[model samples]
Target: MSSIRARLLAALLAGMTVVTLLGTYAIYVNARDAVDELFDYQLRQLALSLRDQAVHHSFAPPAETVAEDFDFVIQVWNPDGVRVYFSQPHRTLPGLAQLGYASITTPDAEWRVFATRLGESIIQVAQPMRVRNAMALNAATRVLVPAFVLLPVLSLLIWLIVGKGLSPLKKLARAVSRRGAQALDPLPVARVPEEVLPVVCALNDLLARLDAALTAQRAFVADAAHELRTPIAALQLQVQLIERAGCEEERAAATTDLKAGVRRASRAVQQLLILARQGSDAESPTLQDFDLGELARSVITGHSVLAAEKAIDLGYTGHEGEVLHLRADAAALQVLLENLVGNAIRYTQRGGRVDVAATRRPAGNIVLEVSDNGPGIPPAERERVFDRFYRGTTAEEPGSGLGLAIVRAIAERHRAKLELDDSEMGGLRVRLTFPMPEHPPASP
Candidate 1:
């Protein structure tokens, strides 16, 4: 894995080295120019000084006597170009040339020569190019050597600074790792850098949501346990009654009651399962474009036998044979409709009417309503009806009290608006308004 500190250190060190090399090259070039100018000036001054000095035709110094470090090679010649005098018996002395400065290349080395007139004779002062080059190299080495020596120190400093800058991220990782599974508390946000603040805030928000979901799950489990206790106990009691019956008639009656108790227990268990499945953190619904009116008719038909037994007039009263299209989770919407229609059938008085309808409003919203001519919920208790395990004060029927709660949960998932109101039929009307899609699918 590539570490941020390592990458930063390498990049910084590489950049510093490149800059150092460039700086050294610039210093070498400038030093070379300065040395060349100084040496050229010295050559001109030497040639001018020789103009007044005495010159001997055979005054050349012995080759062995010349110092190894000696750089200048002075020479003189007559107007006829015959060599007259030379300061040193150098192997590569430049020949006499026209007055002023010039450069000449010999087999051994290149020379910078300054020639001037000394009365009838001509004097020439020359120096090798290698001498000036050595001076420039020494000047550049003074700068380059220090930079190379300090490179390790610069690399160390860069590594420490990069690590220090990343300390906040390290702290955050440690804090997250130390948390327990049940520790859903928000992470600290204080002293967080501006660049990392958004990440911390988002994590805090996620923790808050998880805490709420876990709390609701715990409550749901507890409530389900409490609600199931009564029916299960009743089933046991009814079985005991059947076992104790003395006559054939008494045993038959006891068996019938036991069956009823079993049915009630089964119904309660089913409702509890439905409630759990519709909880906030339950699996997402499968949404599709389906006919809402058809779903309503189907739900009413399923509850028709029960409605008929009680003499309740259960029927669909929406537009005949017209499709009331809606975009929603079809299965969840079916469950919502079943709960509404079943509750209406169970609670309406004998010979009363329970109507289920689905219609599209002019403003492009789908409205689903299940209304019944039964004793309506009081206005004060309407809001509380949607709470889990809550029943109306005047309720006389056996129920798990989760029907309306399930309906409300499904409505919330679909982002639909649910309302409880007095129906025109003189009873409760549960209406749900679902917003239409901006661009609806094409009909077949």
Candidate 2:
């Protein structure tokens, strides 16, 4: 059962054997019937042939004999019930006189008898039943003898045919087994049968997906290592500067710079961990109906103090009472909004206006945007801002460059669209458009 070849071969042979047995039995039965008819005809002809002989009182016994000591017996009984002629002298077929064909049982065997009444004699002719049975068995044997030799040959042919039909699967398995663990390439499907093509296609899809995931993981690891190295080395140098300072003034100054460096390195490590976690499980399904307007307001409030420190105007301008809804993982959506609004606050200059808005437009799309009237990314560099560790030409602030990349990942998770364009407020507009909610928002 563990081997497909053994399983199929056993099933085929078992079914064929059953059919062959039933067929042979049918053939033997039909042939026996035909043989019986042939012998019966011979009996009738022999009886007819002896009719032209003279009517006699005594008969010379037949010179030849068979198993019953006679092949056939002839008797003529006159009208007075006296036996006039008998073909076998010693053996007799015992029965009351029957005018037509009848079975007459004797001491040695049964006989097939045909009796008829002529003008002055009762003509009786009989043959042994054993002889009829022997001829029938011989005929049935002749018809069935070839099948006995043919059964083994037919079984061999069936086995070869089944193996030929399954050879492609064997080749496919061997090809797969030859692959190294690092090889994540798709399997070949062109030479496979139509029945197996779907399985191969599914396996290829799995391999392609696994390969993409592994490649992304490697890239993330390398980029994170490179990004963390700079700040960590700076922190180490700052720590040495603090420890080796010659006076209190110099030591105090070094301590402040070292703490600042620690903050920067800590912030960078935090951002990298966030990016890695999000990338590791990009599409974890935790969907629920939530108000996007409420979420936008919450995110903007968290960054209000940061905006205040820069003397930048930060506020939410969404509709007061209406809910803009969506079904998605709330944690991912929160991260996305924080990145957008935090970047807007961090890069904007003093007195620059930054406004966060969640709106349901006339086209049934829910749009969330953070607009800042500050120096923004140039049109030529807008697309590259989403790449990890990429900074625009105009960027002068100390920051990790994973903000927009994380935003893009979250947008993709929600099937939302992210776009950057020149704001009507005379700076950059970072907009994320989500499709209409799948279900109505909860009553608040």
Candidate 3:
């Protein structure tokens, strides 16, 4: 039952056996019925022939050898019930015959008798029931014998046909089993059966995705190694400088630079972690409606100390009230704003003006901008600045070069567009455009 071939063969054989038995029994029953009708008809004819002969003569014709064996028995009885003529003499059959045809049974056997009245006598013909039944069974067996013989051959043919039909499935399984660990290439679907085509296609899609993921993972590891090497080497050199310094002032200067290098390396690693997390599985972003102006104000306030340390004026503009809001990831957008503002403050000269602004466009889109009067990136290096660890020629400040890269990653995660332009404050302006949600709810 566990094997499909066995189950199919068993079911087929059992059905064939049952049908054969039923048909054979039907044939036998029909044959026996036909035999009964034929023999009864013979008995009637014999009785009439005897009556005609008795009318023409006084006795029956000579009995044949078949009449003496399993043939019909004939008798003539007078009106007074005295035996007159006998074809095969029998004592157990009644001395008298009943009118018409009837079955007469005695202790010895059962007989089918047909009788008719002649001019002055009655002629009767009778045959045994057992003999008629045997004749019918013999006829049925002769016809059904060949069919029973072919049953086994036909069953084997069915088993072979079913096994051949399933060969393609076995081939597919073998092909999959022989693949190696690095074989993330898609499986072929061209020769696959239509019934299994969907399964093969889904597997191919999964393999393609897996291959792309492994490639990205390898690149990430290599990039991380290369980026970490510089800060670690700088830390080691700073440590050596501190160890070799003889005066207290020299030791303090080296220690300060060492701590700064440590801070920069830690910041780079943190940004790398953020970029990796944002690049993965970006289908359903955690989105909710929040005020863009409020977030801008908070970011500017957080950078105020840094702005003051350089004597720069950091302020917000164009955001009178909460008209600009978007459905986006709050934490990711917050990180994006922090990176933009922090980078602007870091690169700007002392006393330079930095402006953070939020404005709603005529098309109902929200635009957020962080602009500064710092020596901004050249037009040639503007696009490259977004690349991971790609610093500009004008960038002389101490930075890990991951700030804009992190900003770009977070902006992409929120489905926002980032563009670089010249600021009115005579520096770079990083503009982010957030599209208005279709079918947005009424503003509160």
Task: Identify the leading candidate in terms of lDDT.
Answer: 1
Model 3 ranges off by over 4 Å: 1-181, 194-199, 281-284, 438-442
- Tens digits of per-residue lDDT for model 3 on 100-161? 88988978678899989887778878888889889999988976787789888988898998
Q: Rank by TM-score, descending?
A: 1, 2, 3
- Positional deviation of 122 in candidate 2, in angstroms? 24
* Deviation from native of the Cα of residue 342 in model 1, angstroms: 0.4
lDDT of 1 by residue, 142-198 (tens): 999999999999999999998888898899889999999999999988899987789
Model 3 lDDT, residue 5, Cα: 79
Instruction: Return the lDDT, model 2, position 322.
Output: 80
Off by over 4 Å in 2: 1-160, 188-190, 280-283, 436-444
lDDT accuracy of residue 63 in candidate 3: 45
lDDT of 1 at 282: 83
Stronger candidate by lDDT (1 vs 3)? 1
Compared with the true structure, model 2 gives a TM-score of 0.67
The lDDT values for all models are: 0.89, 0.81, 0.83
